[model samples]
Target: MKQLKDITVIGVALFAMFFGAGNLIFPPQLGVMSGASWMEAIMGFFTTDVSLSILAIVAVAKSGGSFYSFSSKVSPRFSIVMGIILMLILGPLLALPRTGAVSFEMGIIPLFPSIPQYVFTLVYFGMALLFVINPKGIIDKVAVYLTPLLLLALVSIIVKNMLMPDADFPLTKISNVYAYAFLEGYQTVDALGAVIFSGIILMGLKEKGYTDTSSQVKMMIKSGLVAFSIIGFVYGGLIYLGASGASSIPAGMSRTESFMALVERVFGQYGVWMVAVTVIFACFTTTVGLTTAVAEYFSELTNNKLTYRFNVITITLLSYLLANLGVEQIVLFSGPILGIVYPAILVLVILNLFDKYIHFKGIYSGVVGGTLCFSILMFICESFDSLLVVKDWLLSFPMTTFEMGWLIPAITGGLIASIIYKIKATRTI
Candidate 1:
């Protein structure tokens, strides 16, 4: 019974941590664009946002609760590379800054139209820095109290909206709703966060006297399921609200504007205040939590060559600068970056999850390499529109039509490596 209680507590905290500002902001627009196919869109969104996140946690726990442990199967150097990339995505460059941006966009600007964007961002991160500097009990307190409040508020909005859906739904503009939704979920970057966050959960388990590897892994999986189930349901509800309300959404409104418009339509003026408060609280906690995680990870990874305080200060300042870039630009900058990193992280997580069954180290290295190269090539082709020849060549690959050109090469690389490993093993025997 006590064990169950602990798991519930941790699970809720994990949910709070993963369900950041992006999670709140992205789905409404996704639903609006997905239109009639919103249900299929939600499934694709769930695959990237929820399933990948949980699996990343499981993979880390199974590998003894560290990014290094799981990624080292590929190579020690590869592990370090993965750690650096994950930290950057979760830290100053993207996720951490996004907290302030989201809060400013959803919370502050709507309420205080005259306030300078940078002023709110500065105040937001300053407060977050204070919490992150100490970083011990702040997250726990927020999780225990703030997270539940946020969940309750979101559920209320969802329930109210669902009970009284808009009379006419809009037609979807997206032809490939499932693929578009899947890519949109990448904007959340929770899968990347999951790989880094597993350590935090595992350490908590160890401190709680659940030191056994199997016990930790089992508990982590359970906790992950608990967390992501809530996240997935919330995402679905938000998407439904967006889809139902799409008919009323003006064509020129930005994603955040669309969401705010949705809220106003559903629950009137009071609903806006309710959502603003919830989003600010949620974004603040998420910022503090992610900043602390990145500081701790990088500090330890550097063998204390850089102090935790230094890392915290550096990341906080960098995030503050980027936060002033405004929510839209920050979100735009994230796509190409995530596009390059996400596939590699997914390949690593999937490979690590099945490490025992697939005993060949070469398979790990080969698949990761293939995935990385192909994903980078695809990203470059997309980024440089002048690369028409490259784009044409890439488009000819299997699954390329789905923007999944990496699949065939990754599988082929793994199979070839596995065969080579088996041959070497047989000869040695």
Candidate 2:
């Protein structure tokens, strides 16, 4: 009974961390486009969003709860560089500001059309700052109370929509719906966020006397399962809700607007209120978690030269400025960056899972380096049309048709590195 209680609390905390304001906005749109193929599309999405996330948490746990430790397998220098980049993407540069942007868009803008976006952003971050500043019971409160409310709101919508299914709308078919959805799932950035957020969970477990390495890893896996279970159910239901009520969504509506349309159709005016409440709590809790995690990381990295309060204030202020850009702009800006970063992140997390068995250091550096080069080339090509020559060559590689051109290179690089490592070992002997 005691063990069950512990896992539940930890699991809810993980859920609150990952289920940001934007999370509610994305899945329904995928459902709308997916139509009859929602199941396959969602499975592909679940692979990157939920499965990779759990693997990341387990990887960090195996590394003794330090994200940097896992990355350091490649090299110390590479670890520091990757560490800074991940913090920025998962912090003020992206995810932190996104929470504020999304909260205003989904929670405040529709209800109060007249208010300036900046005003809501300021207030959103201000509230998050207060919660993070104190740092006591924030995680526990979110896990224990806030997550259930978010779940309740979503469940209510799902159940209601299922009982009285709306008229079917025409399904917009993508050539490869599953692959497209898999690529689109990159926007969630949950896999990267999981690596960043694992520190908070590890900290909680340490406080709760989970000290041994083996125990910490076990707790992380169990808690991750809890988080993913809720995420999968809610994500699927939201997708289904959007699919079932597709007719109500106007053509060319933004993802956020589409979701809101679904809610309004299902629950009428009261649905707007339901969405607002859910967005606020869900976004707010996520903001708190991200701010707390970022602040803790930089503070420790700087050895208290940058105080926790100072780091939190700095991140909050920066996020406030970015939030004013609105949700669409932030998400748009994040795409190219995440596309580049996520490939390396995936390679690192997945390889680290076999850390004990993969004794050769070359395996880490080779695969990650290969992924980084290809993903960056992909980003560059997307940014500059002149790079089409390079892009064309990369697309010739396996899985490139699916926008996953990095996979073959990662495997080949690992194999070559293993051979080199063996040759070097033989020469020394």
Candidate 3:
């Protein structure tokens, strides 16, 4: 009974942490695009957004519950590089600021259109900083207070939409529904988040006295399953709601606009406040978790040369400035950067899962390096007109059409590295 209670709390907290800004906005937009193919679209979205995220958690847990340990198998330098990148991206550079931007856009602006975004962001990050400054109690605070309200609002909206007569779903606007949804899922960035968040979860479990490695891994896996199950349900409902309203919503509506439109359609004029309540709490909990995690990470990385309190202040202030960029612009800026980083992280997460069996540590460098090189190439070719030939050649690679052009290189690189390591060992013997 006690174990169940602990898992439920940690799991709900985990869900709240991951289900912020991008998680909320992306689903309905994908539903709008996928239209009648919503099922396929939701599955594809689940494949990356929820499934990969859960896998990342398990991977980190199995690798001793710290991203540094999980990543350092590639090399200590690689670990530090990955750590800095993850913290920055998950910190002021992207995700943290996004929570504030999303909250202001969806939560504040909708209710008080005349309120300056900068003003709302100031108040928003101030509140987030209060929670994060004392990081030990963050999980309890989020799970006990914030998550339930967010869930209630979301569940109510989803249920109300379900009871309504379905609007005719227009033909899907996408060419390949699965691939489009899969790629779009990258916007959630939860997989990247999972790598960092696993440590937080482990810490929370440790606080509950789960000290041993075996027990920690078991609890972490259970907590992840519980967290992602709820995420999958909410995502599916949101996507369905978007599909139902596809014909009625405007073609060029921004994700925030479409989401607000759906809320109003569900609950009438009063839905404005409901939208405010949902977005603010959802983004609030996430901001608290992320700010705490990133602050703790950098403080420890620098051996407390950067104090946690100082890191917290810096992150909050920086996020506030970036929040003023608005949601759309922030999201646009994040895409190429996430595209380049996510594949390498994904490869690392998968390799770390089987760390006990894989004696050749060089395989980690080979696989991740290969993935990164190909991912950068893919990004380059897609970005520049002069690289059309390179882009075409990349498209010829398996799964490139699915935006997974890194897979072949990763496998080939791992094999080559493994053979080289074996030869070296034989020569030494």
Candidate 4:
């Protein structure tokens, strides 16, 4: 009974970290765009949001180390390189900064018409820095306070909307709602967050002296299931809220903005502020976790010459500087970064799990190179309309309409690399 109780609180902390402003904003956008495929879209969203999140706990158990534990399978050098990339990708550059911006847009903006952007940015990041470095009452802080209330308010809105859905539903201009939904889920980066947070949970367990591998595995598994329930409830409610809201919000608003509008309408004045506070707190916690992890990674790599604290301060400042760039700008920048980073990370994850006969050689780099090469080509095609303007030779690849010309090159690269290693028997040498 006590063990089960421990699991509940652990799960709550996991969920709270998972439910940031992006979590709130992403789904409604999906609901709006998912159109007839809302069900499939949300289901797919669940993969990145809920399912992949749970997978993190599972991965931690299997690898028996932090997020980078799986990286050693490829080689320590590759692991460190990949881990650093994942952290920055998940941290201030994208997910962490978005948390503050999203909170301002959804929670604060409606309340005050013209709050200068800098004041909001400074205060928001300040609070995040304070709380992250000095966390209080781990589970209760998030589970009891932020996530549950957010869930309740969201559920009520969605339920009311379902009882009376918008009279007319509008479809997005983009073709293939399911694919769009998948991409929408990709944007949330919840799966990546889960991977990072699992490391946190592992550290938490290790601190409490749950050192036995078998025992730690069991604890992680149970804790992951608990996190799933929280994820499921929140995600489902947000989708419903977005669906209910589609009628009132003008089609002109971007998906992210529309979701914020939906929340404001549903909750009214006080409710909106509550949403803001919740987002700020939730996002803050996640930022701290991400910053700390990255700092620690760099610290270890440099033989602890630079302290973790220094790395945290550096990243937070750099992120704050970038915050002035605003939300849309950040996303625009992330486009190339995400394109390049995501496929490599995905390939690594796949290799980590299913590579019984496979081990990481320097050759894994070949597959990574292949994945990025293709992803980059796809990005160039998406970036420009005319081939004439595409000056760089790297951008001159033949892009197929299948939109997945990258996958072929990545696989081909991985296979060739693997075969070369097998033929040379590099491990023997």
lDDT of each: 0.82, 0.82, 0.88, 0.66
Q: What would the TM-score be for candidate 1 when compared with the true structure? A: 0.91
TM-score of 3: 0.95
Estimated TM-score for each candidate: 0.91, 0.94, 0.95, 0.83
The better candidate by TM-score, 1 or 3, is 3
Stretches > 4 Å off in candidate 2: 165-172, 332-334
Q: Write the per-residue lDDT of candidate 4 for residues 211-312, one digit (tens) a residue.
A: 888877888778778887877876776775665556667767876567667767766665566566556665665665666556666777788797766776
Cα displacement (Å) at residue 103, model 3: 1.5
Number of backbone collisions per candidate, in order? Answer: 0, 0, 0, 0
Cα error, residue 252 of model 3, in Å, equals 2.6
In model 3, where do residues sit more than 4 Å from their true spots?
Answer: 332-334, 382-384
The local distance difference test score of model 4 is 0.66
After superposing candidate 1 on the true structure, give the runs of residues whose Cα lies further than 4 Å from its correct spot. 34-37, 165-167, 170-183, 186-188, 331-334, 383-386, 426-429
Q: Judged by lDDT, which candidate is best?
A: 3
Regarding lDDT, does 1 or 3 come out ahead?
3
Count residue pairs with overlapping backbones in model 4.
0
Tens digits of per-residue lDDT, candidate 2, 36-114, equal: 7888778878876777788888888787788788789999889888888878888898888888877777887778989
Question: Which pairs clash (backbone N, Cα, C closer than 3 Å) in model 2?
Answer: none
Query: What is the TM-score ranking, best to worst?
Result: 3, 2, 1, 4
